[model samples]
Target: MSKTGKSKHRFPEFTDADAWEQRRLGEVAEFAKGRGYSKKDICSEGTPIILYGRLYTNYETVINDVDTYTELQENSVLSSGDEVIVPSSGESAEDISRAAFVQNSGVILGGDLNIIKPNETIQSTFLAITLSNGSQQKELSKRAQGKSVVHLHNSDLKVVNLSFPTLPEQERIGAFFQTLDATIASHQRKHSQRRV
Candidate 1:
C-alpha cells in the first residue's frame, strides 16, 4: 500500500518492500506431465497414488493429506514437495486445469495430470493458487481443447502470467492461506456434523 493504496504485500517484517514481480508461468516453473496408467494398475493396498481424475472430484485448492494408495511400480515416480497437481482432462472448461498442491513427497503421480514444479521464484502453494485463479483459469479454459472432455497440455499451461512477491512475502501469503483453508475445512466439517 505504499502510500498509493494500490495493493502490495506489506508485512510488518518487510513493510517497505516493493510490489510483486510479474512473470509467465513457464518462466519460473515447469509443468511435467504425469506418467500413464490404467485402472488395472490400481491396487487395494500399496503405495499412495495421486490420480489425475481425483483433481476434479476429490481435491481442494490445495491438498496436504493424501489417503489413497496404489501399487507402486518401477516407473511410478513419486511426487516431491513444491509440486502442484492439475487435471489434464475434464468434462468442462471450468473443470479443466483444476489444481491441488502436494506438500510432501512419496505419493506416486498417475496419468492425465500435469505437475507444476515451481522454482525459487515462487512457492508451490502460491503457484497452485495462481494457476487456479480466475483469470488464469479463464486462460486455461481458452487454451483447453476437445469436445466432451476438455484437455490442457503443458504447452498450454506455460502462457499464464503470474505476479509474485519476494520469497518471504510468498511464504507469509502461502502459509496464511494454508491456515485459512484448514480453518474453513474445520468449520465445514462442524457444519456437516450438525446436518447429520
Candidate 2:
C-alpha cells in the first residue's frame, strides 16, 4: 500500500467490485472508423481535417490543410472533444496505440484512425489521458494483432478495462490535466520562438 492507501499505480481507490462500474466503449460512447480519401480529394481550403498519419505520440491535432469534402465520407465525421485513436498503422504494433483528443470542430479523420465520441458520461480529455497512461498503453500493445501491419478494431477497444470515478471527479481530473497541457504548450511556444 502507498500513501494513498492503494497500490502505487492503482487509481480511484475502489474498495470492491461493486464500487467500480464496468462498461463497454460502445455503452459510454460511439466508436467509428475513419474515411478513405484519395490523394486528389485533399484540398487547400474547405473543412478542417485530421488524418491518422499525422497523429503524434502527444495528443496534438496536426492539420495538414483546410480542405473540405462535399460528400459524406464513411466514418469521417468528428466533433470537438472526441477521442481519436490510431488502431492501424504502418509503424510497429507498439506505435499504433497512439491516441489523441480532438479539441477542434468539424474535423474529418482519414482512414487508419478510429474516432471515439463519449456519450456525455465521460470526459474526453480524461479518457485520452487514461488511454495514454503507461499501464493502458501496455494493455493496448498486448491486444494489438497483425502479421504484416498491426491493427486494432472497435471491439478490441470496447473490451479494454477502464477505471473511473464519479462524473464530478472525472471533470476535476480532466481540468487538472488540461491545465498541465496548457502549461506545456506555452513552454513549447516559447521554445519555438527562441529557435526562430
Candidate 3:
C-alpha cells in the first residue's frame, strides 16, 4: 500500500498495461469555483442547478441529471459535462472529500463547489472515482481545515497526487463502475416499490 504508480489490483485486461503515471490533480485538470446563487436562490422552475450539498447527499460518482432548479444568475458557473465537483465546505473533513462527475452539460453549478475540468488525458468519471476513494480521499481529508465547519479549497486539491492509466483504460474502468452504479440504483428502485 505504499504510494506507487502500480495499484495492488487492476482489471484483468490491464494486467499487461503499463504502470499508471502519477500526476498532480491540477496538472491534468483545470480548477474553478462554482459562482453565484445559494439555497435561497433555488426556484421551483428555471435552470437546473447543483448545489454543493447535493454532492454528498444525493449524488454518487456520476451526476447525469439534476433535479434542483434555480434562477440563472449573472456570471454563474455551468457544467460542461466533463467536470468533477467536490464540496468546498462540509460538516466534516470526510464529507468534504466526496467527489462526483457532472455528465450533463449546461447545468448551473451553485456556490461552495469546486469544479475540476479534466483534459483529454483523463476521464471525468474516473477522476471523480479516484478522488472519492483511496489515497486521494484520505489526503483531502487531511488537508481540509476547520473543526466545526470543514473547508476544502482548490489550492488544497491542486497539490494532491493522482495515478492514472492510459485514456482507454480509464474509460473502461469508469464504464465498469458506471454500470455497477446503475444496477445498484435499479435494484434500490425495485426494493422501494416492494415496500410500498
Candidate 4:
C-alpha cells in the first residue's frame, strides 16, 4: 500500500490501481483430478493427451500445444482451456509442486494430475504461475506427502494462500509470462536445431 492506498509496486500502467486482494485457493477455484491413460496408451496419432509427467517435463506457464496423442476412452478427463494442472505424484515433494495452464479444450488430461479451475476472480495462467513458481510453491511443497513417491491432492491445494490484483492485471501478467515462455522455447528450438 502507498500513501494514496494504491499498491506501492505495480506496472507503470497500473500505478493508480488498487492493491491486490488475498484469498485461499479453494475460495477462488474448484478442483478435479485427471483420469485414465498411461505411457503404454500413447499412440502415434489420435486425440491429444497431457499426461501427468508432461507437467514436470514439457510444460511451463502455458500448454498451448501438445505432441502426444492417444486413442480416446469413454471416461477421459478433458481440459476446459481454463484449467491449471499439477502433477499429483512425483519422486519428491518439490518436484510435484509445478503446474501448467491448459490452453486448449478437449485435450485429455491423464491420470495422476490435479486440476484447478479458477472462477472469474482469477486468470488460469496467473493461477498456474502462482502454484508452479510463485511464493505459494514452497507452501505447496510442504503440503505434499509421501516417502518414496510424493503425492499432492486437491485437499492439499485448497488451503494455499494467494494474493491477486484485479482480473485485468492478472490477464496482463499472464500474457507477459506466456510471451516470455514462447520466446524462450523458440530460442531453445533454434539452439537444438543448430546442435543437430
Candidate 5:
C-alpha cells in the first residue's frame, strides 16, 4: 500500500503530506435509495435522467455530460449538482458499487441508485474518485451479492471504508482528476468523430 493508504500513485507535492483520514461512508455522507423509474417513466426527451445502470456503462469516474432524459410523473428525483449516484445492483459483484459524480443540476436521480451526498467537508469529486479507485470499490464489492442481479444495499454502502486526506489535499486531488477527465472526454469526442 502507498502512503495515505492509496494503493497507487500520489501527487509529488503530497508525498510527505499527512496520512489520509479513514472513515466509513456513512460517517461522512448522507445516503438514500433513489426512486425507481418504471419503463413507462423513462423517455428519450424530457428532464435529464441518470439510470443507475448508466453509472457502469456511460460514465467514467465522473459524469458531466448527461445524454438521456425522461419525464417523471413526479419531479422529486432531482440533483442539486453534488450527488454521487452509485449502482445498487448489477449483473455481477464486480459491477456493483460503480459511481458517478453528478454536477449537472436538474438531472433526475433514477431508481436502483444508492445516492451519496457527502457532507460539507468532503469534495464530491474526490469521494467519487475514491470510490472509483480499486481499493474502496473492492471493499464495497465484497459486500455485494454475486448471484444473478447482484445487489448492493444502502446498508452496505454505509459501512464501506473511505480514505481521504486533508481538505486542501482533497481539493487538489479532485481538481486534478476533474481536469484529467475533461481531457479524456475531449479526446474521446475527437476519436469518435474521426471514425465517422
Candidate 6:
C-alpha cells in the first residue's frame, strides 16, 4: 500500500540505507544569485525573465508577450537543465523558499531568485521535484529567517541535504515524468482548440 492509495510499486533503488546518505546541497550543485533588473528594462521581446513570486501557482512557467529584456541586460543565462529557486519573497512565510526548474533556454531569473546548477551526478528535475515536495518545503520553511520579509540565504541552501539514487535511475525517473508532462500538455492544447 502507498500513500496515494494505490499498491506500492517497489523501487529497487530506494533502500533504507540509500535513503540515509547525508549529502550537502552545495556539494551537488552551484548556486548563483540573480541580478537585479529595473522595471524600465523590460520589453515586449528579447529574452524570457522568470519572476520569483509568480511561480507559486504555476509549476510550468507562463510566458508573457509583454515581458522581456535585452541580451546585454541578461547577465545570468539559464539553460534547460538548471534549477531556479525563490530565495526571498513577500512577507508571507509560506511563499518563501519556493523553487522551480528552467525547462527551456533563453530564460533569465528575476531579482528574488537564486539559480542552482546541479552537478553531473544529480538530475535538475530531481532537485526541482524534491524542493517542490511538501516535506522539503517544510524543512526550508524552518531555515527561512527575517523580520518583515522572509529570506533563504545561500548558507541555508548549501546545508540542505538531498538523497539521490544512481545516475541511470535519476535519468529514468526524469524521462518518465517528462513523458507524463508532454501528454498533459497535448491534452490541454487539444481542449483549448475545441473551446475556440
Best of the candidates, lDDT: 3
Q: Write the per-residue lDDT of candidate 4 for residues 133-166, one digit (tens) a residue.
A: 7678999999999999999999999999887888
**Judged by lDDT against the true structure, how good is candidate 2?**
0.64
Model 1: pairs clashing at backbone N, Cα or C within 3 Å: none
Across 1-196, the per-residue lDDT of candidate 2 in tens digits comes to 0111222432453333323344655678788787776446666665666656556533442222333444446665565645545545646667777677776676767677777887777777767777767666677777788878887777778776666555666676667777887788789989999999
Model 6, runs deviating above 4 Å: 1-20, 38-40, 61-71, 74-81, 179-196
Evaluated at residue 68, the lDDT of candidate 1 is 76
Candidate 5 lDDT over residue span 102-180, tens digit each: 9888888888888999998788988988887768889877889857788888888889888888787888898998899
Tell me the deviation in Å of residue 187 in model 4.
1.5
- By lDDT, is 1 or 2 better? 1
* Local accuracy by lDDT, each model: 0.77, 0.64, 0.88, 0.88, 0.81, 0.64
**Tens-digit lDDT string for candidate 6 (1-196):** 1112211342565544433234778888888777776456667767776666557644542222214554546356454545656556556556775666676665777677777788887877667666655566677788888878887877788887766566665666666766776688789889999999
Task: Give candidate 4 regions above 4 Å deviation.
Answer: 1-9
Q: How well does each candidate superpose onto the true structure, as a TM-score?
A: 0.87, 0.73, 0.93, 0.93, 0.87, 0.71
In model 3, state the lDDT of residue 79.
84
Q: What is the C-alpha RMSD of each candidate to the true structure, in Å?
A: 3.4, 5.2, 2.3, 2.7, 2.9, 5.7
Strongest candidate by TM-score: 3
Off by over 4 Å in 2: 1-26, 38-40, 57-84
Per-residue lDDT value at 134 in model 1? 59
lDDT of predicted model 6: 0.64
Clashing pairs in 3: none
In TM-score terms, candidate 5 sits at 0.87
What root-mean-square deviation over C-alphas does model 5 reach? 2.9
Ranked by TM-score, top first: 3, 4, 5, 1, 2, 6
Which residue pairs does candidate 5 place in steric collision? none
